[model samples]
Target: MTEPQTTHFDTVLVANRGEIACRIIRTLRERGIRSIAVYSDADRNARHVSLADAAVRLGGPAPADSYLNVRSVLDAAAKSGSQAIHPGYGFLSENQSFAQACADAGIVFIGPSVHALNMMGDKIRSKNHVAGYGVPTIPGINEPGLSNEQLIEAAGGVGYPMLIKPSAGGGGKGMHIVEREEDLAATLETARRVAQRAFGDDTLLIERLINTPRHIEVQVLADNHGAVIHLGERECSLQRRHQKVIEEAPSPLLDDATRARIGEAACAAARSVGYSGAGTVEFLVSDAAPGEFFFMEMNTRLQVEHPVTEMVTGIDLVDWQVRIAAGEALTVEQSGVHLTGHAVEARVYAENPERGFLPTTGTVLRLHEPSGAGIRVDSSLADGLEIASHYDPMLAKVIAWAPTRLEALTRLDRALGETVVLGVHTNTEYLRLLLQDEDVRAGHLDTGLIERRLPTLAFRGADDHLLAAAALFLHERALNASTTAEANAVWARPTGWRLGEARASRYCLGVSATDSVSVGVRGEPGGASVTVGDGSPVAAGLSAGHDGTMSVDYRGITRVYEVALHGAVLHIGADGFQMELRNRSRAEELAEHLLSRDRVPGAVSPDVRSPMPGTVIAVNAASGDAVEAGQTILVVEAMKMEHKLVAEAAGRVTVNVKTGDLVKLDQIVATITPVNTPDKGATE
Candidate 1:
């Protein structure tokens, strides 16, 4: 191999948004390189924009108009005078055309060559190419442009429980598993539609699904010089719905010999396409037979779980990607790459785990991230930042490093417990619960473990203590906000004071539309007696601390809570749990009570509310159409995931939302009136 020419870049552009963009900018700042950030309209006030030395607007909130627009990204690079463009993992990172456009525009693409991208970017072709290089690949039928009939016919040969994956994208997008022949046809159509919408390519492949598999991927680094090395592997078996939730470096399932063999196979796969920069080679190792492994696919860009690898190997992957793109040779060889302490990372998404992990949207009313020994947070969160459904749901990642795997897990759980993102529902508590599982602690993991353990995991809801804290905090705020004149007047005071016994001020807080808690408080907020529901009265007090946290002493137990009040809603966060309690007015409470009382016995609710805020992608039922229970009425798309709104009862449906309409969370999109109910035309 000939010596490659070297170059230096004074300014580099990050062609992405969110946490990954923020993470890339951090590395660039450390290396003294000016970073330019690009963002969509939805991310105009994003953390990445404030962190970069300079920023440029791409387009609208949609990915097609903004982040994924090749022309706009290249124009931003040219306008900003960027010498190189670093496509952070998601948007245009693995796009072959974007890489070619960078080359044509005389801007360095901080990734592998377009040839390598074309070979590995398509999973179907990559599988074939790796197999030709004598790499062990899973048994599958991977032919481009196979008709639906052809795929369905070939499924028998691949055997049962096969996977249908889109060729053009990584991540878990557009991937479906077929358990029986009856479900194959419908699943294929749905997969193709999703694949085309997401990756702009409907090409797909079939792979035999490995039962109880462990997802292990080797991180490989290659340079312009003929040097390539692997940085061990990561255990990514803890996944939900095919997306990884937890990841750790130096998999406990692999021995020294198996690790070395897998590492070599990853390097060979990279060399087959003359790969360069940082990339990952994924493999499926069955838990039943850990010694054998098969190639899955290769991610041609930095991965979301790359921080765990950096924590264990002490390597900055983004920094190396820049250096390699600037024509720098590989400085560290295979012999020097050593795995140090164990590192574990958990993703914190703006989602409700109890609600089937549905994506949620809210402003960050209060934010508190953990920082201590062996803890690292890669975040794009800030106070008052709006988390919209236009982008990925991931808010941040908390990583912990320790000398042992158990210590690492323990540290990660504690870090999550300290994490508090108020106003938005998150999976922090769920992550801690998963870490405490016996199977997870014993390292008896598989890809299906989280799914199997999900039902058994007990998720905590808002208890009496939390309700008391919220009530007391709100009462205290109201007391402090009273005018001086009002404070001195007995009639104007809000202490619920009376001549004989102090009248308890009753507060009805709404946890949800259908769920509520009644709290009664007597005396002042500083020293009050609180009663939640019909429970016994408890002596409680609320005090303001100097550090912006509120101290709530309930039933002799004092705890500090991160509290924020938006309008009438009170948000309290502590110990990785967050709850939003809305103060209901007397009239609202009375109306809700009447509504509940008016419900006839054995009658189903006619309301069909959207579970989340998103755009209606499809409307399956028309207005005034009769629909059966469990029938899909509409499909709502948010953050690239589609949710179907199903009818809860057999009735005549009234569809209020149409395709392309934006709906809010819990917004009634349709109504289903029972067949026997008379339609009151004047009072409808």
Candidate 2:
């Protein structure tokens, strides 16, 4: 029954980038606080930079040289005259040293105390601390002085199907699941190596892999004055590769009793560490046992999925975090905290889920965010923004909140359908499909749901409508490029005047050079007929708008495509599908082949190309060395994840790039020549 207290700060520096940075800036502006943003070389013109009151450049494009550099961040904070620094999640948000450094510099760190951070930063310590409060925890081991051999022995005792995890990392980095003992050593080594590179800590922890466990994490807010309260939990069971893809609040499976228990446990975890500000205490709930849950890990910062909890609670977590950081009391009591409705958030990422969820990089030629009654899109993207491979691939977070879970799910699907992003390939359509799954619709979810349904989630190739749209878009572009006089002259003549007959030209339109479809187009001006790969012709009416959008009408159905030309590539956005088209006429195709004489069939070198733009982290083989099929030849770090390139067949290797060298997309990093076989007939 107490009025809420408020604290005032004139300026704050955001020590991160992307959507989270933008989210914080919004709250700061709402509170009439000046916001400062720090950017890398790659983000000189980023949306976050433009939205801030002022921005300071850190260093290069790589995170270490920029966002993750503590001294540079502090320097920027000082230069901007910020009274507080909000370390957004991911980049030093949970770093205890960073908090201490802020204190040392007399700048308030908008997070928990260093003591709480130190306790929760290490998973083992946090688990042990919470267990002392009678909170159940997943069986795991992390010893300070254990050797690799001893760690392996300890893992055996924990039982098989164990998870090798990085003790100091999150976001699914440096985590591996081992099904048998034979693969433990290699998995452990790989996990440790990646962990060291990512978190600068190679410490490993072994834990039991709970089968079909639901990932539920409660949002807790505490103050320096010792008041703590839980804002309910978010259901993050939908995941891929241990990383959450979709998150929701008021888990359908959690009865009132179970929800209370988990919330109390989370508060206990927070109180045990003397937690302050916004923090999340994650727990793994058994699907079969319902009420049985165990502590997973605690994220001592605002989580990426915090919006769902905010949506249901009608509270601004960032505001609360700032208030708490300003030495204010937690005015809201546990009884005052209320959950209103259901909410869901699907992370829209710049990744091709169809291709093993590989991160994609390109210039964002166009971006269309969706908005409606129940939809909220938090993003920091703009047209012509270059999506680099240095940081996380998440482009935006689309959240839908409604009175019920089903309505929220339905609204999320619709919102996802309305999203449009060109140039960079995204997983919007993939998210929509996942939302439509029967199990997902019914709230039957688990941590392994996505992995189990990946086969069905793979791309099934573009449909007829997509091909027709591509062809029509190209045809319209060619017409638009012609001079007014030339276009008039062509229109005056017959439909196929060049061929001396009314005939359609069969143009080869393809998603790629190899994946193509033939479309027959015949028209004069303002009208055309398009037939897809031996299908019946559909009469179409086409017109161009001043904004480069093409309006097409076929069989009483009208569709508008936002088309843009970037050199030889045509970006098409229609019907929630973003496609890149490369059109080639028959004559042009022949000319291209005739002019290209470098490649010879059967004599072509089998070079292993970098799948995406990244830096070469390691080279496992040198020139003239032999390698077997499926052996890792090189390791590439892109979008903060390591991708190991393996040989496709037995061959002699030829490495092309040195470690730490930046490589371009499709750049050849190595080559493989098939092993020679004996000429048995000649020898005999």
Candidate 3:
């Protein structure tokens, strides 16, 4: 490899946003390089913007209009006087034309050469090129012009349990693992759709599937000097939906011989494409008796899993990317490379694992991250920072490194347990369960492990009764704590007399996915006790906290609650959920019933009620507006989604809450027109 003719750049433009943008910006700042940031309209208040020396707007919320548009990216770079563009991990990071544009404009792109991008961007081409370098690929042909008939016949030849993958796709797109004759056609159709969306190609290639194989990949750094070195392999088998979950260095299944073989193969694959800068060569490893490995693909850019490599190899991959782009030859030789200790990284996402990893968006109310030895948190978010719905839901990467994998797992679990996030829901609990799972700890890692063993990990961790009790306790403490030295003695101590009665109230609570509420709340200094009506049993609960934080336990479910009363609204966080308590009468009823259940007098009302509190967006029927049963009478908005308030029985409306008014839970939004005009078989 020869050194490039031009290399100097005073400012580097991060051509992406979110955590990776902040990550690259940190490196740029330490090197005395001014950073330029580009953001979409949705990311105007993002972390990357605040960290850079300069920033430019890229317009719109969609990736096509902002992140993936090369002209916009380059224009931002040029406007901010940046000569180098760091594409981060996604979007156009691997697009050959984006890389070529930088080179064509005499701007440095922190990745491989244009020719290497063109070659490796195509999965079939990358596979064939590496296979030519004597690397083992999954048993299949990458040669073009194979008909569907030939593929069907080849499937039989390759045996059952083969996969059909788009020849030019990655990241699980256009890939299907088929095990039966009847499944091939549907799987092919799926693969085609994925390929068309991802790679713009529907053509596919078939490969023999490796049953329960581990996903091991090597980190490679190469220079234009024809020198390439491998930094060992990472075990990333714990995945869902073909995307990586947990990733670690020094795969537990790899022995000396396998490591050497895989490392050499990965390096050779890089050499095949004349790859320069940091890249990863991935492989699929079988846990079968023979323990075989096959080439997967090479990511032509930095990986999200690079932190594990850094922990083991003690090298900054981003710095190498910059140095390589600056025409600096890699100084390390193969013999000088070293892999040490163990590192585990979990991607803490703004998603609900129980809900199938659906993206979650909200504000960061109170952020309390873990701090200790051997733990690293890579996040660029702050409290009150809104989690936008426009970008990927990955909020941060929480990584831990230790002398042993078990220690790392334990540390990671502890870190997750201690981390507190408010407003936005996250998967911190999910990561903890993943690490604690027996199969995961036993090191039987594979790409399908998490998905295959998700049933046990799907439990939602938050309990509403405990959360309600905790919130109630905080509510009392806040009312008590809101005192000053001048007024503290008289106003704060309401029950200080020896002859007076010391009493507390009780609340009956109900918890649901969208909202949790208490009918009544009993409070005390030591703790607060309450009960939850689960439609079957009313379980007793207890919550205690010195500060605003509280924990409540009812039955076997324990919910940790953090309470902050901000002005007009009370902000509560429990079980990775947020609930804003407004004026609601059900809170009073539930609280009263909770105190009276079995032991005390029951005052639970017989009145029909609304389920939750919300604004009455419309008052369709007035005091005499007759309505049919089940007809829409009002509208309510909650948590950004809308709900319709309907009539239960046909009658004249008794009372209608005006629009723009807050309606309490179980409050009358609107009643039937008249009881006499009620629909048949329907009662008030």
- The most accurate candidate by TM-score is 1
Q: Candidate 2 residues 1-684, lDDT tens each? A: 454345579999999999999999999999899999999999999999999999999999888899989999999999999989999899889888899999999999999899999998887777878899988998878665555778888886788899888888887777899999999888878887888877888888889989789999999999988798999999999998889999999898899888899999999999998888999989998888888999988999999999999999999999998889887897899999889989999998888775577788889887788998988888978999999888999999999999999999999998888888888888887898899999999999999988888887645465676666667666665656666775658654334446466677666765653346788778843678888888998887767733357777777777787777676677777645676776766776675556445557545447787777788889898889999988999999889767898888789998999999988756778989898878878754
List candidate 1 stretches off by more than 4 Å: 545-547, 677-684
Candidate 3 C-alpha lDDT tens digits along 1-684: 444664666999999888899999998988889999998987888888999998999989768899999999988887888888999988889988999899888788889988898888877788888888999998875665566666776677787888788877776655678889988777777777767766777778888888887888899999878899999999988888787878899889988888888899999999998899999998888877325789988999999989989988899999889988888888999898888889999988876565456555667777877779988888867777887655667888889999999999999888877777766667777788789899889887777788777875656433545445544554455446657775455335432323454333333223432234443343443343443334323344444554357665555566667765444344566434444443324555566456456442443222224444445566666667777777777776433224566777666666556787765445655655335534788876
The predicted structure with the larger lDDT, 1 or 2, is 1
Candidate 3, which ten residues in sequence have the lowest lDDT sum? 506-515
Point out where model 2 deviates above 4 Å: 1-7, 458-460, 484-495, 503-506, 533-538, 544-548, 551-558, 585-588, 591-607, 622-627, 652-676, 679-684
Clashes of each: 0, 0, 24
Error of 3 at 323 (Å): 0.3
By how many angstroms RMSD does model 3 differ from the true structure?
Answer: 8.5
Instruction: Provide the overall lDDT of each model, using Cα atoms, as 2-decimal numbers.
Output: 0.92, 0.85, 0.74
Query: Clashing pairs in model 1?
Result: none
**lDDT for 332 (candidate 2):** 93
- Model 1: lowest-lDDT 10 consecutive positions: 542-551
lDDT for model 2: 0.85
TM-score of each: 0.97, 0.92, 0.78
Residue 407, model 1, lDDT = 99
**Better candidate by lDDT, 2 or 3:** 2
